[model samples]
Target: MSDVVYTTTHRVVVPFYVYAGLAFLVATGMLFTGAAEFSGHYFQPHILAITHTMALGWGTMIILGASHQLLPVLMEGELYSVKLAYLSYTFTGIGIALLVWAFYIFHMGWPAKCGALLINAGVIAFFVNVVMSIVKSKKENIQAIFMLTAAGWLAFTTLAGGLLICNFTENILPDGSLHYLSLHAHIGIVGWFLLLVMGVGSRLIPMFLISKYDSPKILWSIYGLINGGLITFIFIFLREAVSVLYMIPVLCVTGGIVLFGFFCRKAYRQRIRRQVDEEMKISLLAVVMMVLPLVFLIAVIVTLMTISADVHMVLAYGFTIFFGWLTAIILGMTFKTLPFIIWNRVYHARAGTGATPVPKELFSSRLFNIMAVCFIIGFISFVAGIVISNGIAMKVGALLLLLCAFLYNANVFKLLFHKDRML
Candidate 1:
């Protein structure tokens, strides 16, 4: 790796963080307003709106931006085209704003349909750009393969979502819309989010730790288990199969999680750097959070097998995956990666000529610590409220989460406006 590996300009990445910040702010507001009733049902209009805001607006948008910058470094090549990156971002940003607005109003009209189409188009643009970049790159590694595969899953997920939106407007699905929602959710969650995190984390974690740990075999196994499990899931889900067969996908996903845990442990044990930063600590905590879903999934499977599928357990599982694990990782990694990009832009020219603040100085660690504590407390209280059906606890949790979001935005602005020579 080089001192600076980002080939994409700051213009490409900065707007994404801006969009993500706005999305997080909006999501926090939704949670605060609907806190008392958010856990009541997963399919409510408000819930759907908030979920898409988090998933597409906050999560997918940031990933797309970061991937454009990181993929070149991972593949040891330059980006194929910056214009396509801008187009992808524009389409995705506009599409998500429209889609979330439509969902918030519980309207399945032309606006929502058009939003879905725009989102699908944006995803297509992204997929084409990434695939072409990989093809022209000199490096052909497992990390690139993981990214390419995740891009495929993203395309499929978007297409499925677009079709679902169309079905809402035109009643195109032979079955109910709810049946396909699960498929769409899983494809986005497991196939796209989980796989991308694992793929990217595998490369970045060890690199950050300054450890010379490499395990191609373990990574290969992790890949096989996840893809195999997802394929089996798609088949069963599409066929509408019943029985214990659904457990197979759950087990495969769990197996991947377990293997990843081991992989992280190996990386930690072999790490040369003794002191890990707060950002990395939060990211490592996310790795631990990944196991919570497995536990919830077990409960979900058990309920399905014995009595009935419990909506509460299902909600818990989804919540753990998205908010607990995925959100934590993204929040943590944003600080870890974003500072470097900003640093390169601000201090690259001043290197050796004068004293330039390091990337770590771009933001306050104390603020990050506060945000982390609030996040964990808020997440736990919210989940507990859901489990116990307590509205007060949920409200408290939402308020705390809102505070965390505020702190997050504050720190982000601090970094964005950081001066080379701080007083």
Candidate 2:
């Protein structure tokens, strides 16, 4: 592999990823605990706390850290300022802390409102810095291209989220607060998280797999379909005519998935490293999980044609996306990415010396596989629990998820502390 020319001296961004990973671990743990409470009947505060804790605290935090590290490489220029990066982290951290506290402990009120505002401010600041840097860059890269678009969506996500928060306190929406929650969540999930993942995966997966079959066209197709579908969906759904409008975006999104699946298949076939790690193997399951929600949504739309689904069905679908698919992908990818990050930053310089270890030699794949199995079982149980309102199943599922989080964090810390290994 050749040296990636765009890298700069700033390694501060690396810590952000680590911090975000730590946050993810904690938030995931909280999610399990909170889920247990949800099992013991259902509490709005517990659900809200767990959902935001994972979404904002875990997912957004990691994305923020990764984007900071990626921008310089993609833009072919240094970040506009490291101080701004630090400031963004600080503000977001404070906001998340307060917001979580208010949700779990104090309910949605002034504290939650204030936290939402601050979180939105931090998000806006991050977007401004990133967008401006991209515009000012000397060269345009695909990673940067996807990121800029994703950042725009992130801004929308946060803005909508802020409004939702305000609605909790002040009833800003006429139809009630959760009327637009699906729209808000999907935009963030598909637009910001999913798009960025596909974009970055298009680049990194090939590199990591050591494959030469580059399909930029497929990537563009995925981008176009997903974003186009989102735009069309928003336009139609926002019109208050929910009947036919929902179908438009649903079809569009399915088309996007087809494009991505084709590309993923191509990449897998072309990959030189035939026998990959357990992480790669398990991550495949995540890709497969993507279809579950779509199938559920189709059923939902059809059901609504007769009679709409209750909140439980909606919650079931949401859990599948949030934990089943997205969380699984993140967990599997973290194993790969975290090891590489650790190796690159801590052990790369010492390579070929007797002291340094290879990246592959990092952790016990057996251990990871055990956790993955536990997680899958837990996830399935939890989804079943939600659908059937089985408290016992839900509690078991939460415990399993909690165990996975603990194992993941322990593995990460093992890598960080014992720097001799490639992890």
Q: Alpha-carbon error at 289 in model 1, in Å?
A: 0.5
- Whole-model lDDT per candidate: 0.87, 0.75
Which stretches of candidate 1 lie above 4 Å from their native place?
A: 1-6, 352-354
* Candidate 2, residue 143: lDDT: 69
Candidate 1: tens digits of C-alpha lDDT, residues 386-423: 88888888898888888888898898888888767733
TM-score, prediction 1: 0.97
Error of 2 at 278 (Å): 1.1
State the lDDT of candidate 2 residue by residue for 55-108, as single tens digits. Answer: 787778777876777687777777887777777787887888789889888567
Query: In model 2, which runs have C-alpha deviations exceeding 4 angstroms?
Result: 1-4, 8-11, 14-43, 352-355, 420-423
lDDT of 1: 0.87
